[model samples]
Structures are given as structure tokens and as C-alpha cells.
Target: MEFFEKLKALSYRARLTIVLHTVFTLAETIGGVFFNLYLWRLTSSLALIAQYQFFFWLAMMLGFILIGYAFKNKGMSQLFRIGFWLNFIFFCLIVWLGERSINWTVYLGLLSGLAAGFYWSAHEVMVLSGTSDKTREMFYGVLMSGESVARIAGPALSAGLIWLGAKWRGEALFGYYLLFAFVALLFLVTELAINRVKDVSFERFSLRGVFGLYQRKAWRWNLWRSFVDGLMISRWFVWGVLSYLILTSEVWLGTMMSLVGVLAIISNILIGQWFKPNLRARLNSWGAALLVIAGIAYPLLLNPLGLVFDQILGEIIGIPLFTFAWLAWFYLAVETDYDGKKRQFEYYAGHEIWQGIGRILSIGLFWLLASNLEQVNLARWWFGGLSLLFIVQWWLLKKVRTALVKAGYKEE
Candidate 1:
């Protein structure tokens, strides 16, 4: 029975794709953190770093939209291929400009944003097709675990490379470029490997048929519920991530990010292994509630701590930092069984839109209100208010969960 079961599992397309995807994720994860660190180092301005984040998020939003239409039109594979190579080229460009100057760093940020735009959209769509919702959430957890591992491994490796470069008369940014090159190499290799996998026919990959599920009233309500859950939470996460960048230094940023990554990985593992699929929806609701609290507290927290200590805590808490935990939760929520294709897209779109809104509002708030407040005042009052918001967020999540039950959702 064990032999037969192993054989059966080996025949699954998703399992194969997950393996290939993991390889791609590991490289990108390392390359991406190093890239961000280098960019922050060059500019040392939180606003500029936030601008880079804005562009990256904006690109993903637009890319997902286009990928949706493209999937509907049967051009999914072509666009994804474009994404793979575009990422390759983008990393290569970063490698070519490893002098660590301000202008080059700005250029790197733009290119990285462009690359992320391509990579995230295509990668997400591809992953969606590769697994059903039954396994997709678990699959996502696995993939994230790979990334979290990379988070720890990438920085450690980059730190080593930086040391080597220092000894060899090479610039520190060269270490970043080296990591980029290695990651780009992984993308190309994976692209080649994916070509060998059996191609998914557009007919079997149905946008219309899948979307028809959304026509059901139950699914529609569930989707809307999921969307609200995402919107309420993501606003604070993005705001906090950028705000922290303003205060954190490049040298320690990767280590801090890695700690957050570790927390996310742990979360993903717990969800995939212990949480039942039905219960996962409620868990997402709870997670979003936590995010709202974290969101409100993070800025206040950043305000009070000097950049150094803030950096220390950011690593320890891992919630509102520059890690992927927020998006991971948002995706898990949207991909719940109660949601249909329409809701999935809506959830994705809503998450991005809310993040964008949060970024804009937070920036304004900081500049208008918090910027003038002394660190002590900001810490005491701002964090206090944030803590209250978290409590509110928790209440809101419970209310949403109850509403889901009232709407006849057996799981959520």
C-alpha cells in the first residue's frame, strides 16, 4: 500500500510543479532581500524606499489584471515565460551595476520593481493552475516554507559573500549582484525544467467555467467576506513595512527580515499540517484581526525605538515587518473552498488596492501628524492607539466570522 501510494503521488502534476517552483522561490528570495538592502543603503530615505515598494505593488496589481485576461484568452504559458526571462534580465542588470552608488541603486530599485511585477503575477497565476483549492493552500504553505528557508539562508550567504568581497577588493554591492546572478540562474533553469512538464491545456484551465462557480450566491458572499478580511488587515502591514524601512539600517535589515520569515514559515507549517481546510478560513479571519492590531502598533513602535532597537524588535515579532506573512495570510483566506474564481480575483485585487491606499494614507499621516511628534510621545500615544485598533480588529474579525456562519457558511 505504501509503495502504491508513493507511486500515485509521484504521478501528480502539482507535486512536480511544486518541486520546480520551490527551486525558483529559493533563488528569488535570496536575491530579493539583498536587492532591497542595497537599495535602502544607497538612498537612506524611507520615502524613496516606500516609493520603490509602491511601484512593485502597483506592477503586481496591473500584472495580475493582465494575466487574468491573458488566461481567459489562452495565453497563460507565453506570459509566464516572459516573466521568467524578464526576472533573469532584471537580476543581471543589477549585477552589471554593482558599484553601490546612489544613481545605480535607484536604477536597481526600478528594475527590481519591474522584475517583481512580472515574477509575482505570472508565478501566482501559474501556481493557481497547478493545484486545486483542496491542496492549494497547503501547497502555498510549502512554497512559503521554501521562501522562509531562503530568508535565513540568503542573508547568511550574502553576509558571507560580503565578507569575501571585502577581502578581495570587490565592493559590498557585488555580493548582492552575485546573489542576483545565482538566483537568475535558478529561474532560467526552472524555466527550462517547466518546459519538460506536460503542458496544461487552456481548455482544462477554464477561466469561464471556474468563474461560473461565483454565480452561486453562497460563493459570492464568501468571496466578499474574504475580501473584507484582506482589506482590513493589509492596510496596516504595508504601512508598517515601509515605515520600518525608514528607521532600519541595511546591514541588519536582512537578519531582521529573516526572523520575520522564520515566523511566517512556522505559521505556514502549522496551517498546512494541523489546521483543517474548513477551519483555515476562520484562522485567516483571526490572522487578519491580528494584522490590524499589528498595523496600528508598528508605526508607534517604530517611532519610539531608535532605529537600532526597532530593527531588533521587528526581527523578533515578524508580523508587520518587511516579510511575506501578511500576503501569505491574505492568499490563504481568498483561496478558501468557499470562494470561487471571481472572488479569488476580487480578493487579490482588493488586497493590492488596500495596500496601496494604506501606503498613501500612512505616508500622509506620518508627515502630517506623527513626524512632528517626539519619539516618546509617539511611542506612548501612537502605540497605545494602535493597540486599541488591534483590539478593534479582533472584534471585527469575530463579527465577520459570526456573519459567515449566519450566511450559512459551514466552514468559515
Candidate 2:
């Protein structure tokens, strides 16, 4: 009822946009779990996992750049549809190849990455497409809540499918087969929702328009902020193999992930409904500080209970507030700036490159290090390194926040 009450206050477009995003994210979360599961069940090599992600993000970054250069505003909307079809095809290829799928890991990564790029490039633009500044913060809060819900539901549901299939067929991969078919269907549902939210036009794109954004004093630090934010990409996605190996139970893994969503639901709802424009600084600073503490604990404690604790702290004190603060500032900057909106495609594409560069460097380093370094040492090098990067990211965000305000935009 409370969630429904909040949605009632937003525009129909905004409501539909939230549904679109929620469903896409739900599909992504399900696919993510299975992709990791399939590869690990076959290869059991963490470095190969990193390599797969490396190509995926590399493809994703290049995809954004290519789409930026190639697509007009109208074509931009079509990227959403393209991503779904490609992703569906990727899943089909994986299922078709079966045990032989490991042979196509490189091509698989490239395909997955390009599909993700198309999906997210549209996401970048549509994030604020449906709402005005007046309702932007609330939109984010609700959006966060919905995404959290999806994250929890996706994994729990997947785990159940796996368990059911394992019981019935006595084969774990059978569960993945079922999950893949279901997620492909989800893509169709996501596309349907996207069509309901009518497209809005951004300023005409030109190479010169993109280069002009780099010259702006306010935007310079925001780009750097994105790079710093990217340093944690490895931290975010590579956990499926580790968790499954560590706990040896997808049930436990799914439960832990579901708990994260439960906590996020509480936090995001509060942030969305109760947060004020003035709390941005406090919220961000608090989130970063807790991230340092939680991140450090994450690497230091490697057991099942320890990982659960780490997730709890990250959701409660770290990710939710921090995400809200940064995103509010991020979307606000683009919403108000004259050049920022006119050159929005280039603007988001540039951020993607900077962040993608950071992700590639970190994930690529993981691929290299995981091959050479011991597991315990690699844990410290990976998670501990991300802790420090989060602080730097927050500091850069502070600079951008100040620069945006000084550039004549209000904090809201």
C-alpha cells in the first residue's frame, strides 16, 4: 500500500519507466547468477571468470561508443529492443552449446557485453526521462526500492528452480536450462513496458557537442568521479563463483542475496520518502565511511556468516544512502545544465567510457592477479583495494557536487 501510494504521486510515464527498469534488472540478476553458475560448474577457474567479464565490459564500453556515434535519438530507443534480442540469443547459444559452451567464452563475453551496453545506454538516458526535478529524488528512491526487490526475488527464485530441477532430474545444469528460458521471456516483458513509456528527445548529437562537454569546469570532475566509481566493478560482479564455492550451496547464496534486498527495501523506501535535498552531503559521507568499514570486513572475513554480515553493513550504511546521494546529484547535473541535456548522449557515453576504463583496468588486473596471486592475498588485493577507491570516489563526488552548485544549479 505504501509503495502504491508513492507511485500514485508520479507521472504515468515515470511509473511505467520504473516498471521497465525493475523488470530488466530482475532479468539481469537471474541471468547473472546462471552465467556464473554455468561457467564455474564447468571450468572452476576464477581467472577465466574475470576474463569473461573483462570482455563483457570491454564490449559494453565499445558498444556505447559505437551506438553514440551511429544512432540518432530515435534509434536510441531501439537499442533497448536490440539488447533484449541479443541477450536472448546469447542465452540460447549458451543453452544450445551445453557442455561445449565453455569453448565460446570469449565470444560469449563479447555478446553479453554488447547486449548490456545496449540495455544500459538506453537506461542511462531514460533514468530521468520520465520525471522532472521536482520528483526526481522520489523516483530514485522508489527505483532503488524496486531494484532491491528484484535482486532479492531473482536469486531466491533461481535457487528454487535449481533445487527443484536437481531434485527432479538429479542434474544441476537442468535448473539453469529452466532459468534461461524464463529470463528470455522476461526480456519480452521488459520491451513491452518500455514501449508504454513514450520517448522524449534530447538535443541533437554531434562529435563537436561531445568534445564541448569536456571543456566545462563543472563536468570535468564528474567524469573523474565516474572513473573512480568504476574501480569497484570487479567488486560488484565476480562473487557468484566465490560464494558458491565457499558456501557450497546456492540456497545459502540466494538467501544471503535475498536478505540484501530486504535491508535495501527498508533503506531505499526511507531515502525515497523521507530524504531532503540538504541531506546529500551527510548521506554520501556516511555511506562512503561505512563502505570502508564493511569492505575491509568483507575481505578479512571469508566465511558464510562473515559474508552475510558484510552484506548487511553494506546495504544498511553504505550502498543505499551513497547511491541515492550520488545519483541525485548526478541526474540533477544533467537535468539542469543547458549543454548537458543538449549533448546528453555524448555526456553519458563519456561517463561510460571513463567508468568502463576503470572497470576494465580493475577486472583486467583481477584476471592477471588471480592467475598469479594466491586466493587469500587476492581477496585483500581485490576487496581492500576497492575500499580505498570508494573513498576517492566519494571525494571526487564532493568536488563535482560543489562544482555543480557553483555552476549555478541548486543542489536539488
Candidate 3:
């Protein structure tokens, strides 16, 4: 009850931003997870999926590079609209392609990447502008809670729809079409709603200027954090979990994801109330340690029982800690310099580029490794490597905290 009141007390722009984000999150949750499943069904080749993801990240990097130019010339609102429309077009392509989606997976990946790059870059800036450091943590908590609810509903709804379609017409693809169409409609609504939100002024930005950050010792930790974050996103969540799902049932996948979503909701609430800014550094360290442990436990994917335990452990223990801590750290890093307001878009674009490089390396390695190894050995080695990467992420997180402290940024 108190939480609801506090959420309602947010400024109009903040509330609008949260609402818009929730809608977008719901639409994404509906179809985003299944898109990979759709591809795997079309072509049961891990290498092909890796290729698609590689191209996706590559294109995303390119999109980030162009984001600065877009922001300077067009403004954040236009970039947001372009992203929304591109995503709609991508889903439409998925429907049109149908089972033949395998034929154009690479191209689809590129399209998806471009859409994500533009949408996320603009979205990050909006979040920064809409909330202050005082309200940032609470706002993110509400946002994440909303997203978790959407995630819970989205997967179940998608799975039920797919099941019904398969039962009625003897083809689950029909359900996918329905899901994509629904999401496309949501995108249209989002496009219209975006107009109601205020826009940020155009600021001078350059891709070349991003190079200057590399020269600053104070900003070096952010670069490392970006790369590590990218690695985790690709190796653990994208390829690692997807690989497990490929071996399991869709019903099980949907159920497990919903369970995780429920746990996320609880974590969001707790973090919102208890996570203090002063405790950020210590908490983040603990969170990164849990992630490393989760990565080490990835070998449990060998058997069904072990797989279930592994998922439960990750969702219940590892994800909530790491997710909240990382987000808090990110907010700190972005807002610490205060100059982020005028150059926020450029900073985000640069962050995306670094993250993209990390993902490219990860998926590229996955493609190469999977090509050479058998299924059993591949899972072991792939997840084992991912565990090592998590350690690197932890190290980077610590360094980031140290760097921020040295730069005279207040812990609270």
C-alpha cells in the first residue's frame, strides 16, 4: 500500500515514462523470448543461432555509432519513434517469413539489433532526464516490478496461445503469428503515446568524441563494466539459457520463466525498500559473487533434475542480487559526473559499443566452439567458460567502485 502511494507521488514525466516503459516491456516480453525458440525450431543448429546473434550485435554496434548523429540532428523523440517502427517491421517480417524465417535469420538479426540500439539509447536518456538521483532507485524498482509482472503474464499467455493454435490447427506457428501481431499493435500504441512525452533538446554529439573517454582514467572503469556486462548478457542469458531451453519442453520453459518473474517481483520490492545508496559497493560485490557461483553451477544442465535446480538457484539467488546491484551501479556511473545530462546520449552510445564488442566475442566463441564439439561436451565447456567470465565481471565491478570513490563521488 505504501509502495503504491510512493509510486503515485512521482512527477508526471516520471509516471508517463514508467507507463510507456511498462507497455514496451510487456510487448517485448510477449514475443522476444520466443523469437529464439522460433529460430531453433526452424533450424536446429546452434551455430546458425550463434551466427544470427553475432550479426545482431554487429549491427547493434553500428546502430550505436550512428545514434550520436541521429540525436544531434533529429532529437531523442525521433530516435525512439524510429526504433519503435523498426521493431514493428521486424515482427511483421517474422510473420511474413513464417517457417521460412530460417532463410533470413541473419538479416532479421540485423534489423532487431538496429531497433534495440536506437530504442535503448533513447530510453536510457529519457530515464536519466525523468528522474533524479534521489528518485532513481525507487523508480527503477517500480519499473522492474512492472516488467516482472509483464514477464510472468507474457510467457504464459504466449505459451497458452501457442498451445491452443497447435491444438486447433495442428501448427503452433499460428500462435506465434497471433503473438507478433498483438505486439505490433502495442508498438503502434507506444508510437502514439511517445508523442505525449516531452522531448530532449538536440545536443552536439560525435562518435569520435567517445574516444576521449578512453583517455580519462576516471571513466576507464565504466568501459570495463560495459564489456563485462556484455559478456554476461550474451554468454549466460542469451546462449546459455537458450541452450537449456532447446533441450527442454516449451511448457516447462514458460513455467520456469514465470516462476523467475515472480521471484524478480519480490526482489524488486525488497530492493526498493532496503537498498541504501551507501551500501551500493558492498552489495554489488556480494551480487557479483552470487553470479559467479551461479555460473559455476551451470554444469547442472546435464540432467533434468539438475537443470531444474540450476534454474531455481539462478532465479532465486543469483539474478535479483546481480540485476539490482548492476543497475544501481550504472545509475551511479551515469550520474556521477553531472555532465551526463548534456552528453548522456553519447555516453550511452559508447557504452553500447563496448558491450557489443564483448557480446561479439562471446557469440563468436560459441559459434566456433559449438562447431567443433559434440553436444554433451559443448554444454560443459561453454558454460565452464562463462563461469570464468563472471569472475572477470566481478573484478571489473570492484574496480568501478574503487574508481568512483577515488574520483570523489559521494557514496550516498
Task: Report the lDDT tens digits of candidate 3 across residue range 118-180.
Answer: 878777877777787667677878888788888788777777877777888898778778878
In model 3, the Cα lDDT at residue 293 comes to: 64
Q: Which residue pairs overlap in candidate 3's backbone? A: none
Name the best candidate (by lDDT): 2
Better model by lDDT: candidate 1 vs candidate 2: 2
Q: Whose lDDT is higher: candidate 2's or candidate 3's?
A: 2
Q: Candidate 2 lDDT, tens digit per residue, 86-107? A: 8888888877888887888889
Cα lDDT tens digits, model 1, 143-197, are 6566667666666666666656655766666566666777788778766655534
In model 1, the clashing pairs are 293-390
Off by over 4 Å in 1: 1-13, 99-111, 126-137, 196-198, 201-267, 281-408
Give each model a TM-score: 0.66, 0.94, 0.91
**What stretches of model 3 exceed 4 Å from their correct place?**
236-247, 304-308
Candidate 2 has a TM-score of: 0.94
Rate residue 67 of model 1 by lDDT. 54
